[model samples]
Target: MKRSKALKVETMFNNFKLTFFLQPLHGLPETLSDTANANWPWQQDINWFLALAEFKRLTQQPTLHFFLLEVWSEHTRCLALPLCSTKDGRYWSSLTDVYSPSFNIISSTTLIIANPWQCLLHALTQLQPNWVYCQLSPLRQEQIQQLTKLNGCLRTHVFEHSENWLANCSSNQEYWHKRPGQLKNTIKRKRAKLLSSGSRIEIHSQLTDELMLKYWQVYQQSWKQPETDRYFINWLANYSAANGMLRLGLLFIDEQPVACQLWLVHHSKAAIYKLAQDQAFDNLSPGTVLMADMVNYVIDIDKVTSIDFLTGNDNYKAMWMDFNFKLYGAELFNINSLTGRWLWSKQWLKTTLKTIARQMHHLIFRARHDN
Candidate 1:
């Protein structure tokens, strides 16, 4: 089957058996309840925000087919499956499988009689695409393996877990107050110096669209390059505003906006959505100051349960959260087929090479730093 240029949601919905139940989860509803759609820091609903950004990104590619799979239930909230397919290249799909036993059951059953490992398996069987790609949390490795064994029609790839740090303000003051000793002291001194020097920091619970747009402009200036998903900024600005999820924290040095961060607040947790800081204020550690202020504000003022430093596997995340959630991605294929066996061998070779290269790079960097 040839990939279609124009992807109609209705057509995609009609092609699948579970479409009627899953469509609403993808933001197809005429109206969504606050309870159902309320933003949660680490919950799957936040992916709704991520998916829209992804969808808008793919829409820019005039030749690609974009399809979104949304799933919902009273028991579990909304989940989105954003997929992009191109005739000449690989098909890409966002991970929609929630981390739960029920999801594992459904996925396992589907693979028993299906060619592929996911709901997209049905679509792939019908469409016969070159490849179908999906991202899964690292914690779901067991489930992925199970599906691959059942279907014998997929390959698995693994990637780093996007780290998130959480601290409950109401219960654990120590966690909220704690930070890396050196970094914490440096930021504390900076904050004290700035306060004594008459600088002020302001935290806003809600942001106006105009102010959010200003932050995006600052982001563009900071990067100084166009990203593949240019529409992401606009989507975030609008979605946060529409859903009352926007939290803008600004660090002003003598009444000038030197640093700013966009955060999402939901279900007693706050997530660091995006950040922008002026290059000139780098010496003052404006970004660090802003983060400190947010930690305190969420704990003392907003009384949020936790805050997530999403996506960066940085050293800072390790210091903040004792435990981290691992994100896993894999390719599943039939081990019995010659093509599948060949693909697996090639992937294993590539992974081995990359691992060796990474270790070599780390050693070289460490030696240089020690010198």
Candidate 2:
């Protein structure tokens, strides 16, 4: 199989150099800062090999291997990884590494050296695996379009929307204050109720292992109801503990946990990775109150440039978000190969069928409503 070529140490400065490398977790660079203006959440910089190693150690998964690409610039450095899970029970490949690529459409020279789509195509063509996956920030539309054009790639699926709202610290406060309308009224009512009942919302930076375990229990119970599996919760807890950029924002009412959110600081942006709410307190809107507080906290206290609601296309995200971008998943292969050609044809037929089915469903539903 043709693995991506690695650039020689001497010619690393030449035009658009590329390399494929691997290292152990213990051998990670002492600090991500050593790589010139790299993003925060230092654990992401631990080198792809080390990150995977730590993941393996904590999760005890023995069949995983890491493939990484290092991209360099005069003012910045970044890394990408093609993660493959070879475990008997698990089956998938992902493009999720630590640091995210810079997204400025203009003046972002980093793309010359690191093209994640190209790297992924090479991996797929060589491996010819079951599926390739990556969670792209909804903001990168150009990148998505480029990947969609790949010869044998198919966009198998995508999550519909996010349930949270993301915004920048510098956004107009007055606008936000007036935007929520009835939702805002509900929040105030909930806060008044909590206070009247002698309860208070307290945010914490550090949590005990026992508390963390409790948070996980709530998270697992909520997560299991969904069609997707929560495979990364365990890895996230350990990773957040090891990396300072990761934080847990918890809301406690009278010393008992009511809500918790897992947040990560990357570059100048904050991401709401996971959230859980206590079922007993659902009537009081504890989750909403915690989210509202967290939003203000990130903007006022942390001073991040933006917040990402992550994957979903939820209505709440649209309500408060001033910006949004579409996300796509695609598969690529060598079109000339027999298997690749067959898979591509299958995808086209499936997509066509889906479109027809959707239209028919809509028509039938409309007729029933009319009747």
Candidate 3:
């Protein structure tokens, strides 16, 4: 029987049946809330997927086709793969967005499932014969390495996305001391100037209804690009505020809102989610001053272990968050499809050429060193 793009796979992986459920966790035989292998509950649990579904709905984004691939050994489930296919049904991805910090696939660490990655690929290949690509992203280096190393697909390629920045806060004094002198001097000068110019500035932390109104007002006047979904940011602020994770900071100049930043604190880590500052306040450097104060607040007041400047490799980010972890993504290609085949070959050739170039450079370096 010919299968459609939304076809399900019921393949056997060494006797373990790989079943794809059309619904979310409700379709699963058992909840993975208490799964023994769940290290990162936020990323791996059933609730996270449900939240993503709700987020999409609330944001009015196109609904994705959710897939719950459960691997069962006899009647006991070994692992579950939570996946979301795009509206076009050609690409498979995680239930993640720009806001999602990371992604994960729950698997039993104790279970000796030989070549589970291969089984996953086989099942996907059979289910979506015309599948062009797959991407699971915002993953750490270890996570990316695991997928690429265990990959059974010949055309899978790994790509570095960004250098996610982090600030280790031993203390406010220590953290500030390590900062570049130029940064400190600029903030000091700009802040003093703003104050002396009779521009009374105030920074607020609460996401109250009044503050929320001021936030959107200033954000519109800011230099930052417009958000694709404006409602999602507002929703995120409310959600984070309810969870006591919202650290939405608004900077005002004489009662007029000039700058606003969206930050979230959770699990003893503070993330700099979003920030916007009015271009009219560029001379005052409200962004820089606000950031400095926020940093001090997160460390001395909030007592967060670390401050994450998530999802950017901006030059200024390096000055504040000195330490960084590289985030990566992988592209999986199907050799059976013509477009996929070309993509695979091109990627292969690019990789091989890079390898050759590096080897040649190494050889030349060695000969030069001998001289």
Clash pairs for candidate 2? 25-50, 153-331, 154-331, 160-313, 161-312, 161-313, 161-314, 162-312, 162-313, 162-314
Q: What is the Cα-based lDDT of residue 318 in candidate 2?
A: 68
How many backbone clashes does every candidate have?
Answer: 17, 10, 0
TM-score per candidate, chains pooled: 0.68, 0.66, 0.77
Scored by CA lDDT, what does every candidate get? 0.54, 0.52, 0.71
Question: Model 3 Cα displacement at 61 (Å)?
Answer: 7.3
Model 2 Cα lDDT, one tens digit per residue, 1-371:
13333321212323544333322124333323343234433223433335545455445455554444333343343344434444321233443432232221111235553445655444433333443333333234465566655444444333322233456556438436645587778879997877665565554454467767767655654532441323345445555555555567766677777777777765667787777887877787777777787777766666777877766666776655666655444344344545546665776788789999999999999999999
Give the winner by TM-score: 1 or 2: 1
Better of 2 and 3 by TM-score: 3
What candidate 2 gets wrong by more than 4 Å, as runs, is 1-37, 40-65, 69-79, 85-92, 95-116, 119-139, 149-165, 217-243, 352-371
lDDT of 1 by residue, 155-186 (tens): 67665444444554554457645656877788
Compare the candidates by lDDT and give the number of the best one.
3
How far residue 230's Cα lies from its native spot in candidate 2, in Å, is: 9.7
**Residue-wise C-alpha lDDT for candidate 3, range 80-127, written one tens digit per residue:** 666777665577776677767677666665456766656666666676
Give the higher-TM-score candidate: 1 or 3.
3
